[model samples]
Target chain A: MKIPSNLAKSSLLATGIFWVIGMTDGFHINMMAFMFISYIPVFVCCTGTILLTICPFYFFGETKHFSKRQVFQRFYPYYSIVCFALCAYGIYENTNETFLIGFFVAAFFTTMQSWIWFAKESADETV
Target chain B: MKIIITIIASMLFSTLFYDQHIGLNLTVFSLVTLVALGISNPSKLRMKETLIVMGLYLLTAILVFFNHSLLSIIANCAVFFTLVGSFSEATSSVYVKWLNGIYSSIAGTFHRNFEDKSENKKPWNEDVDVLHLIKIIVIPLVVVILFVLLYKDGNPFFEEKVAAINFDFINFQWILFCLLGYYLFSNIIVPVKVQPATDSDLATENQLKPLEPLNEDNLKKEKQLGTVVLALLNTLIVLYIISDIAFLLSNTNFAASVLSNQVHNGINALIASIIFAIIIILYFFRGNLNFFDENKTLKNLSYLWIFLNAFLVLLIIVKNAQYIDAFGLTYKRIGVYVYLFMTFIGLTTTFLKVYQIKNLWFLFRKNVSVAFMLLVLCSVVDWDAFITNYNIKNADSLDVNYLIELSNNNAFILHQKKDRMVLKSNQGARIDLKYSNYVSVLEQSNWQELSYDNFKLKTDIKSYEDTK
Candidate 1:
């Protein structure tokens, strides 16, 4: 379960951005440029923590024998749908609007990246 | 049959006793849940094991009656985890099995769509099945809507009856409770792979096996380095101990004056020194030191240092006690006591590891088990009430502001002592605001927040009001 260096790098970058945004919201930082931010960091922190915690289980050597591609094939479509629903709810809901939007955006990117990586892996296996 | 009985009993117990004393309610709930599980699967849990778990739960409930302190929360968590772990082990299960159960349950719901297209030909053939489902759905919908319409017609009796059927709003607490119930039920019912004990055995085996001795050149280098480090530490600690006796212990006034400045300032440094001593000992005794008979001096020196560490821990405890005497007790001060106790246990364990040649796992297991037991015992205490009572009676300077800010468990005590409180103008205003907030919280509290502590506080406040 060797994650491609590029994917790992991208995931790390995403984590950093999410963490920084979460800190800003948690601390109630109201810089003029960042006034648009709200509670999105709360959602991102939660989702990001989930992703980080799950990564080790997925990438460990004992799990490598399984078809890694099948993970995304089976789970990603449902994941994407849930993310879409959350995004819609975030936009529609009045409270913590910014935070919800931020959460959905991070979740959306995670779902997309997972789909792309798994799709490519599946294709490579077939080849 | 047993599971059904259990569920029915649980619902009845929760519903009937929902507004009663929280301790009794929680005890009944836990006992019912445990009984249900035991009766449903008598073969899986031994009578002794079941009794032990029940006793722990009973203890937790009893503690709630005493006070709603951090100890009770920790004790509750311990019981929960132990219950889950024991059930999981008894059921021959792993966390993966729980995950799989959740996954399958979700996936099974939508699985018909993924079935073969040929199966659709018989879809209408299963009209009877569809009708049964429709009845199941429509009956509930009709009953609810009918009741709602009837209530809307403005019949007071119907409205009263309808209102009595309390429907909890969909919220995080409700969801969490549901999830907890589901988790407990599922874990008890479903059996999975029992985790092999091989991993722990292998870990202990590795720790027990000594590392290869350093090469002669490296051994000489290490011996020289170890000698210098141990000698320097021993000399410094001995000198500090001597000075402590002369200056701190000999003069009670000096000790009192130092503690008056701050309670736990010097304790941190003492904790750090103990940690460093443990590390230093482990470093020198990495492998068997029998190869060099000369290393005996270092071992003796290390033993002396360990003794000194224990003494240092004692000194810190005495200092903390003096501080408590001058100022007052808080959670942090109590925590420092617990922390120092653990550190002393650790230092003793380290001595055993070095002298008795115990493995790292032995040290770890013994220390953790002791700590767990300590926590369980601690949970039986209501520290908030203890602190409030102690501070009020013992301290020269009373901080009513701090006392008022404590949990509702201490509310009754604070109210009783209200006449004795000496408050400044600003503090008086703050107390008034806090008192109003406390009253509103009591008024706003629902059955969910009902507990023995809160209930008692409420009663006391009511009695006070009645007298007024």
Candidate 2:
């Protein structure tokens, strides 16, 4: 029961969407700094969000079998590049918080691009 | 068994929603959806789907309870339809879901139980289908009721002979309403996905490479046709834009009606031409023609065409701004801006589709997703207040009548602006009307129906009372 790669990729992209949009909303940058100090609740939030995303893929994905590595394949390369670029930009501009968001979205699309490649390759199986 | 469930659901819908405000009744209605789904299609009743449907219901309920404006009502209907569609297909486009939703509603209300021709159908005696029940009971009851009415008009003493079905909840009209509700709930409880529409949305493939051979003669012909059409279109659009800019530069002053006609008609024509542009692009790029080795010229021309259309949209926006500057902001004018912005999004997506050799469904999915997000965002804004306040401050010739026609969302603003406007008496009367409408809007409300906006309005009224 091998799962089509697109569903796993879509779920990853969905999680990135949640992080980029949800983290940036309502809670300001200053509040986000506090989230770092009160780290337990933040950890809980991350776990809940991941589970919320993963549950859907587990249900609607092509197979019952779940592999975390398959979804994360080729993700590190793009994430690393995006992370470095955002870090460099943050240092240059003397802006830390906004570039934190810059990192979220950068990782979002980097993860998105990685998944999109998988999605494209696995299009026939899903469609 | 499902028929019995449908009847129960119908009874619940008719009883709860008959004379109630959209409050907890919406939550109740959502529960009915859950119960119906649980009974008929228990396996599909997952937590994700139930929670999402419940969320949609809660959102619709909250929006209407707060404002109950036309936009809120429209959003409510949209959410309801999306929920109905969600029961059947989880991955279809919102538009297709809406189509499926509306189809289910119509089919149910009309007792057109369009089930699968092979296995889903049951004999009338075997199971009481909606149409069979309609034939056995509703037709006779309706004819008898019609004749009773006619006979009551003909002979004064014949009213009692009609058997006196005049109970408050058991009357003929109420029964018919329940019957219709039963049919509707029946269809909704067991959702139907229009296969072709759902199939199209399920098609995630964006590329056109597999439709035909890249070296096909038709691909070359399509490329040639597309190139010629786009080139000619580009020339014409450039000329049109130049003349438009020339006119805007020269015409410093003009009649209001002239500007109004120009702006409105320009937008109308722009909508048509943009749609035409998209259609042509979709047609030319529909297939393996995109994979043609020499399709670069056609693709470049299409991109230029899209960019020029985007420019045209901007030019119209400028014209609309000029019109607004001269006159005032109204709903129609504001609507033009929203429409233009969405049109720009459409063009951008079209450009992406052609550039990436994506299929038309890709364009649809992107634009529709954006449009839905925009709609959800719009549901949060009180546009009545925005339009009224902006017009009150900036309109050269304020139409107090038009301002008065708006909902109570702008009531507080109008009340504040009464002293500042030249038309004090008219403004005062409009404010009074708003107060009366606000009262009526909340006449049947419990705490569940009171929105934060309503509380704010009440507070505003109280503050005004204290000052007075």
Best candidate (score: lDDT): 2
Q: Give one digit per residue, the lDDT tens place, for model 1 in A30-126.
A: 2312432423443355445445633443454124455544444345435544555665576568345445544555544444554444334444445
Worst 10 residues of 2 chain A by lDDT: A68-77
lDDT tens digits, residue span B1-468, model 1 = 744664566355545343343444455555665666567666656645445655776678667545556567667656655554444343212222222333222222122222212133344344477668868996896576666755645787876665565433434323333433443344344322212332233334414454575476776778788878988998998888777656565666534457744346557667679879987877777675535556777778888888988887777777788778777898878988999899889988888877766666666666776776787888877776788889988987777778777776676666666666777667666655656676676566556444565566667778778866
Give the number of the best model, judged by TM-score.
2
- lDDT tens per residue, model 2, B1-468: 988888888887777666455555565565677567667776555647445655765666566656556676677777777777776676677777776676555343222221221224553555557768768885786576556556766775665554454334435435544765786687687676655557766775656566643567877777888899989999998898888889889887868898888788788878888988999999988778777788889888888888988998988898888888877888888889889989999999998888887887788778887886677567766788878888888888787778887866777777766767777555677677786777677655664455555567677778778867
- For each candidate in turn, the TM-score is 0.62, 0.62
- For model 1 the local lDDT of residue B213 reads 59
Cα lDDT over the full model 2: 0.65
lDDT of each: 0.58, 0.65
Predicted structure 1: lDDT: 0.58
TM-score of chain B of each: 0.69, 0.76
Candidate 2: regions farther than 4 A off: A1-127, B1-12, B20-57, B108-180, B196-205, B210-222, B250-255, B424-427, B437-457
